[model samples]
Target: MKLLFLNWIFLITVCYSEKDGKHLEVRERLKTALLQDYDKTLIPLMNSRQPVVVELGLSTMSMDLQGDGLLNMTNGNILQWKDARLRWNPEVYSNITSIRIPASKIWIPDIQVYNAVNYGENSFSDSLRNPDRHLAIVTSDGKVLLYTTHKLQIRCDVAKTVPGPGEVFIDRGQLDWPWGKYECEISMGSWTYSSSQIDLKPYLNRNYIEYLDQNNSPYLFTEDSFKDENVITCTRFKCCADLYQMARFKFKVEKRGTVTAQGLKLMKKDDKMLLISPFLLFTLVIISIIGTLFTISKLCHRKPNFLVE
Candidate 1:
């Protein structure tokens, strides 16, 4: 009976290994078939003129920097769309419903942060367009998902956007400084594709806004939401009768105690010295008066010593 049990275990392990080998073979074949004639530069659409509908979602991995009319955020962009060219019959491939592939292997939408700071053609900008940032999951039905995390440099108009007490608006862009609340609205879309090439939609509104290091964050998201048709690229830009599909996110950021601590540490040495100027001047005046008095007292008490000298 013991010998029979050992044999049974061996048979089961062999079966699993055999099944795994079959799966690996299927994956390799699928990859080759999909890419053998695939065009990575063109849009994966059945017709050339039809716009590809791309569902978009975003969440903040970290609040990297916010000041001087600029906001930098490490954000996760959830992009999903269907590509008829990538579809396959799962039955032939061991019924595998999904497979993972590097994003560089396929043609993806040319999405851009339209309002990004330094939105120019440079090395940093080129890096943003690099497909290395994402690893996509392709489904047997031709649906592809690419979740990409990027450090977005966006234009911030916190001074004008903040609401509430009038005095809060009086302080320059930084009145809130290490304190107060500010509004940051970010717009994203294909800068070159236009609405004709792509139909952009915000798929998950508030779902992806989780802060990775909440404890160390200098600002808190006071108001965050994925708005209804009310806000998803809802605000249109009319140019030459062509509409640009857009995704815009509005975040209300308030200062945390950590910001104040950092604000002091970041203060310039010159600025700190200037802060104590009045006190330093007062101390110098007191010392000067004491020294003058001591000198007078010595002269009054040492007339004989002066004559000997």
Candidate 2:
């Protein structure tokens, strides 16, 4: 009976392993399919300037200084001052047009945009064409800027996209490039302006704008959803020659429902383990019952064992 119980446990383990293996296999295939499908279904729309909904998530703002004599007053110094702040009403930003994506369903793929001719020629001609033109971010004060910048860089964590336990599709081609870092420098002359304040806004509107891609192809899309009505106010400090300052902003915005339909179907399929697990449990119960009955019967059939009289 003990051996039978062990065998049953082994069998259940094997079944679970088999089921999980199948799920892993399907998920891998689905990831590949999702990447291809995104390139097919959404990439064109993105390139064509279709408005893709993005949810405004958490955001951060920071500022610092660089260069020699930042706090000192000296001759022939390049005195520069920079400050960063975000000016967006969270309530208003959330109320803006958006799609309800199960928090887990959103993913921002690691997007790489290579100049059309500089990098090795690839088959995805469209991607190679003006890749940077489609990617942009809105500041708190209604300014639109490209995701790629020389002094400032912004990036969102791939892990943060799926926070909860709910299953979500890979949604590969889609991207949610968040503001990662911002750095600036000014040199050559003594400090003229005392201090400069930059206001960043997060708002999206329905206004359409046109831009040229890397390939010089024309495209249009609704302007940034995150918009700020106010502008940054700056106060000049006492003139100093060798003053320098730098600023950085880090923010997270939810890019909801970027996944394709086919990818969603595959995600649901992978979660079918919830349905299949009950049957597996029932099999284990039956095995336990048989083992108990066999043990009882063996005891009952034992020859009457009386102390040798």
Q: What is the C-alpha lDDT of each candidate?
A: 0.68, 0.28
Q: Which parts of model 2 are misplaced by more than 4 Å?
A: 37-49, 53-63, 67-309
lDDT tens readout by residue for model 2, 112-147: 211112223321222223344233332333222322
**Residue 193 in candidate 1, Cα distance off native in Å:** 1.6
> Which candidate number has the best lDDT?
1
What C-alpha RMSD separates each model from the true structure?
11.7, 28.4
The model with the greatest TM-score is: 1
Error of 1 at 141 (Å): 1.1
Give the residue spans of candidate 1 off by over 4 A: 1-13, 48-50, 64-67, 118-128, 158-175, 205-213, 224-229, 234-241, 257-309
What would you estimate as the lDDT of candidate 1?
A: 0.68
TM-score of each: 0.68, 0.24
